[model samples]
Target: WTILRTRLGWSRQRPARRAVERDEDAIVAWRENEWPRIKK
Candidate 1:
């Protein structure tokens, strides 16, 4: 376990909630531009 953790850089934390290929810029644009319009 120690060898795997150290040598292979493994972690015990939970996986990320977001997608690996998620578009951050698009999400930001939607939040800043579209979401406000929709919320109103």
Candidate 2:
């Protein structure tokens, strides 16, 4: 952690995540079927 914060100049941040169950197929469906609509 010190190396990351000092040498690399990285700081802690809120991690992004999605549902553990929605990883592969369900996620693909959301991107194809729902995400585009939401983007518009």
Candidate 3:
């Protein structure tokens, strides 16, 4: 859910994201945004 929300928010901010949310981008954002929670 965290990853999904991050992707959604990131997507909204990017013009190209309207085309697609690439797997790599989502994974990167997921690591950057949600990794802290996972580590805890």
Whose lDDT is greatest here?
1
Give the C-alpha miss distance for residue 9 in model 2, angstroms: 16
CA RMSD of all predictions: 10.4, 7.5, 11.0
Candidate 2: C-alpha lDDT: 0.87
Tell me the spans in candidate 1 whose CA falls farther than 4 Å from its real position: 1-16
| Model 3: per-residue Cα lDDT over 1-40, one tens digit each | 6687787664334564445646887889999999988999
lDDT string for model 1 (1-40, tens) is 9899999999778865978899999999999999999999
lDDT of 2 by residue, 1-40 (tens): 9998999999998859766666698778999999999999
Per-model TM values vs. the true structure: 0.51, 0.45, 0.40
**lDDT-best of 1 and 3:** 1
Best of the two (1, 3) by TM-score: 1
* Pairs of colliding residues, candidate 2: none
The lowest-lDDT stretch of 10 consecutive residues in candidate 1 is: 11-20
Candidate 2's displacement at residue 6, Å, is 18
- What's model 3's overall lDDT? 0.74
Candidate 3 residue pairs in backbone clash: none
Quote the positional error of residue 6 for candidate 1 in Å.
Answer: 44
